[model samples]
Target: MSFTTFLKSVPAFRSLATREVERLSSQCEPVAYPQGQQIIRKGDPGDAMYVIRRGEVKVPIVDEHGREKLVIRLGAGEFFGEMALLTGEPRNADVFAETEVECLVIRRKPLQDFLHKHTGVASFLTEILGRRLLEGDGIRTVGKYRLVGELGRGGMAHVFEGLHPQLNMAVAIKMLSHELVYDEEFASRFREEAKIMAGLKHENIVEVIDSEEAYATFFIIMEKVVGTVLSRMIDTRGVIPFDETRRILSQLASALDHAHTHGIIHRDIKPANVIIEESGRVKLMDFGIAKTQKEAEQEDEDIVGTAEYMSPEQALGRKMDGRADIYSLGILAYEMLTGRLPFDSPDPYEILRRHVRDEVPSPKLLNQRVPDDLAELVRRACAKKPEDRFQRCADIVKFLQQDAPAAIDLSKARAKVFTVIYDPEREEQVTGLFRRALAEARKIRGARISISDMNRIY
Candidate 1:
């Protein structure tokens, strides 16, 4: 098939006017591949979306162990790289020629320009996107979580409200979107996120009960609650009451602090990631884009974060840390107190650009009702330079608890570490009122080594 003929058959281009299709065809660069040639590499920057004009190409599922299996094949009129091209993200999979193949590659800029002018083109792609392969039969079960109903769909996964068959306990099941299961890099990351969340146990962090790599999908079971996401509250109430905001901030800060201590940095921390339970408990959810201390992925054209809450380093694709999360928390705090972001503008990209170079306005300037001290805290927490922000997320909780009772000051309540010199002959099982505080002891050749830090490390 010729490039124009293939475009005509593509559902997205089918709706386009003859002139528009011609324009796209003129902008397309015809590319050819011999049988078994590698086309797209997973994790490489995607600059264009490709349409198959002749022959076939296969997307092989490659595992972390370096094994590969053929997952899907594309023929004439079919397209790939839509997600990468649309979001300007790295390629999520590897494509190889199944046979001698010919393709028409439309670069991102021209494709974006065309998409802007032809709105229905996006609608057509939406239809293709919504067609998840395994959803055809409707997945009814994954591991022990029996799916009751669909809770919601996120960018990369579909969440389901479910229950345990035996325990009869309520749970939320999150499954990686079927389409992404074939993209092993994404699938591995999806599983890794569950592992990270599983390691985190805190009152303010959502609990991960289980994670499984089922035959058809990867799913995670988590504790569920009947309540609303914080985003909805902010939407309905404009701004949260100052006292309520402080309480919520304390919980969120603690959650971030705990994760940081555990060597996890949640790259996304907008209100939508926070769930407010009926019991008034705050549960931070989703570590989908989080980076752990051991993650070796380099930064540079690999920016991945929500634009509104992105920190300066995140927006610029620079190295990030727990301080990046602090910046996001400040944005969340400012929004809760002022009912608006400090970097609001008509253009979204400009908002991101502002976070990189613009100064954060004092929250009090937006709402006089905001306390001056709180306003200053917000400004400092959101400074463009990470060093200017709160050095630790625990500091945010400490700042909020300044007026609380001395007992509520977590720093004062911090568990104490002690140096215990013990001889094998003298050791007769130690016990005291500090039993709970008596953390770990390392058994040496003839004695025990005292814990330098308590068991409650976080």
Candidate 2:
């Protein structure tokens, strides 16, 4: 078929007049990619859209863990990259030639000009794009659960707030990214995460309710935790009180101890993965990278976990055990008491380097109010050598409960709670006031101020 005829067959250009199609076809440059060559990579600048003229191409989604999954395969007359081209955004997926592929590439400037000259065609194309976006991996329901809203996204999956109509219960649904469902390895890993969580039952750990494959993807339903994430609490209320920090750390340690007993190591343990209930209960979550002790012994060597909280051995991709979790828990403890990470940098590698090599500064130096015994515990828990650190999570828990001293000056350690009542209309002004207040409070040594409540006066 002639290029002009082929262009007319494409859904996006079907509305164009014959003469307009011919003009657009004249601007299209034919290009060929050898088999296995990358045509477009994720995050690359999108300058043009491609229409497969002959042979086939495969679209793959690559996650942060360096795992790739085939998203779709496009044959002759099929199109890709239009969304990125129209929105001027980076390519969202990688495209590679399945065979010796010939494609008609339409550059941005000419396409924009052509669309401007054909308003009706532009409208039709917009409608098609909207439909494609809505139909592409945008699942609204899974099995008996109806997903209501997105809670958050991690490296491997997107978590949604879901509801069951029959039970009238709310649940958190962790859906493996639609792009990753096709890869057996990723799917199995996701199932393994669910299996691990389901097997371990503890008060401090978030419980897995069910796991299902629906809408061609895998999702794990978990008990919906209604509370604030620990990270948000740390951000809003800097330098948590010694009592609260000890309680939180103790609960986390107990949870880790249970998992470790079962031969599971929660490879990722950070404040963001912990939710604090109003009743002072801590629920640990997101076992996306959790591995068994046996799995750790194998030479997989995939360094995973947040850089800021990574243990020394984890940063080096060395074999880890329950002691690794203790190390991470120690980092969390340092952040909780000091209101800052022991090692932080814009570059992740630098942070990892510090975790592996640098000696952690004493927590007492960062926050003078930190009890001497607690500071010593933090230092020992974060020891560079695994053997030097707390051998078990229970040891840390016991130390926090029995050995850690109470604050010498309770008056200085206690945070003054303030409740601000304001008209709902003055929210912006009140928010600005709070920001200024926080900024000023940070300047004062050992001074910590946080807005505990905001009540609206009708």
Candidate 3:
């Protein structure tokens, strides 16, 4: 398989684009080992993880008396040594090749360095580690809901497919992890999201059915959706068709428009959180992490959302609004059209920096099939500054449907275009010309610009 294809084969790595997988592949060195060779020893320092290209490796359990017992067997495509990467701990178990093995080995320092920089990778790792740290067996129920099956888990919560005892309605129950429930601040945030979601009622969005703390566990129940998430669809299809992308975008924009009208900001709008029904209908999920207008104002260092889809303000940990969601939707729109994110890095921190400062290349540059108008819309939506982007979801819908009127060019209106000259003699004239140009531009826009610029146009 190709390098990118190999990475996508791993469930955790599927969300990453081909270019990102290529970059990661560069850090890995191919190595081989023969049968019975000890690859990792218990208590040894771990600074690297290896993905098996071929052969089998067995993790053995050893008693204090040095008796060995076979615990689990890992084969081609499986990874080992992540415990060290996640927790900085020594190897917990000894791994020996059960057969001749070839693997791609990525060293710890380089991997951790990359992980520290990329928010998406960090979020993925958190989910993986969270699962490992929590019960591997899993919880069967929470309060009134009897969990029929597990849906998914993240750093702070585990979701289960469940049903209410009295109502018998199908529901998805999200229980705050026991380890996190004790954190008053985190619990408050969780509760706040529940309350905010409870207030919203929209068909395009998942409905929050109920929330409560029972038997020391905090859980929220939402309408269960038996459909595939868009991210998984992207993984299987590589790139979504423009028509389908447009359809999904329209539905999602409608959902956001409704939520924004209700004063809620999704804060996270990646493909992973969008569900596509069997009938091709869209249902936006995971309001358990959305922020409200009131909550958005609180100053805190805590950051949320998958790093790849974060708006500039969200990545910077600054206060956010509905426009932040607009920016995130732009990123998703880009991915839907081009099959990749506009910005990527081995360091997620750089991704945040770029979101706040870099320009998003047009979608047509990556995919010839993307129409120029759609590409331009994506560019504007993903603009670095909130004021530079489409101000609302309604604007996006109107643009997509070709019903939008001649709209304001927010960038020129909000920006000062200075014409600098070397001649010191005409300073006053140049300054006067600048004032006249500014005045005319403002008059044409029908809005007063509270901007000040000394330089004038020629």
Candidate 4:
């Protein structure tokens, strides 16, 4: 049979126009795998979908304990990896050649482009995949966890409350958005997020229990915290009391310290990512754009963080470390104390520019009730230079543990001061000179400079 004829018989391509099918057939690359060879491995990034032309393959589902069970077998004309191709999710199962096999592989981009141009085929494929996710009773499940209710939705994924029938335990199931399934970057980040969270086991950090993929979509199972997000709490109560803020910041700091020690950096840290349980325990969640120390070093410079809470380095798209998280925590601390962000603007770029150029205003300036020492702590944490900020979250915790007035000497904390004398008459020239000097000084961690008007001083 002609390649186009065979493609027309495939369920996904059945609805496509003859020319569409011909276009897809022209893009298919045929390859063969010997019997006993592994065709696909679980957790590998999916790049293409395949249609069998000859022979057979066995699909094996592996359990948590590393045991594998043969789930299904496929023969000539059957297709596999369609879900991964459509969703950009990792392969969920291992496939082995049951016999010498020949497959016509359709690469991801062309197929996606084809689907984009043909909405009917895309919808048809979606309906077929959607049916595969539903059980006999009409309950939708990812692995063994059945989704019960939607907790929330974000740009990357939708969070659902789920229950495991066998385990009889409830969990928060985070499913990648279908709209983002074809976005390779988002898909990779979602998969890495699961791995990062699964490795971390801290009481103050939301625990990741498991991750699964069904019908080419990824789901992360996490412990459900019964509490409100810190953002909502701040919105409802305005300013949190100092004692409550201290407790929340301390717990959150410890969680961050733990993650940092493990070489993970939580790039997106904001009030919205924190949860305050009914018992007053703090649970830090969301590590979507996180990276390991090594990964950060190798990563291309891309600004990825919450604008208002971003560190100066992050705002400039520079490489960052755990200090970035400490800076964000400082912003969170400021919000908790003053009932407002240290920097706020309608335009995100303006906010990012402010993070890079302006000094964080003292929380005490906004709220008179803020203790001088505590306000100093927030200022240090949100310093324009990462080196000037608290080097570690553990240090933040230690500062919070001590009696603020006795533990911190305000004069010493502000001791590093540089005097820059510029002529007032040549204001434009002075401004340009100051910008150059400031840029150079920021390169040195913990370096401080104070500008003075030469006209006023002289």
Q: Which window of 10 residues has the lowest lDDT sum in candidate 4?
A: 118-127
- Those runs of model 2 whose alpha carbons end farther than 4 Å from true positions after fitting are 1-139, 403-458
- How large is the C-alpha RMSD of every model relative to the true structure? 18.6, 14.6, 19.9, 18.5
TM-score for each candidate, following the candidate numbering: 0.60, 0.62, 0.57, 0.63
Better of 1 and 3 by TM-score: 1
Q: Scored by CA lDDT, what does every candidate get? A: 0.76, 0.81, 0.76, 0.81
lDDT of 4 by residue, 1-458 (tens): 88999878877567567876776677789999999999898899988888999999999776788787546899997888876664677888888999999999878877677654543334334434544444353436778888776687665666878897778898998877654555667778889999999999999999999999765567899999999999999999888866678789999999999999999999889999999999999999998889998887664567887898998887887778999899999999999988899788899999998888899998888888787667988989998888899999999999988843234455776554556565567788868877788656644433345665545653
Best by TM-score: 4
lDDT of 2 by residue, 350-453 (tens): 99999999998888888888877678778888999999999999998888878544445865566565567777898899889888887567545444355665
- Model 1 residue runs over 4 Å out of place are 1-139, 405-458
- RMSD after Cα superposition, model 1: 18.6
Tens-place lDDT digits, model 1, residues 133-182: 22543335666666777687755777777888888998988877544654
* Candidate scoring better on lDDT of 1 and 2: 2
Q: How well does candidate 3 match the true structure in TM-score terms?
A: 0.57
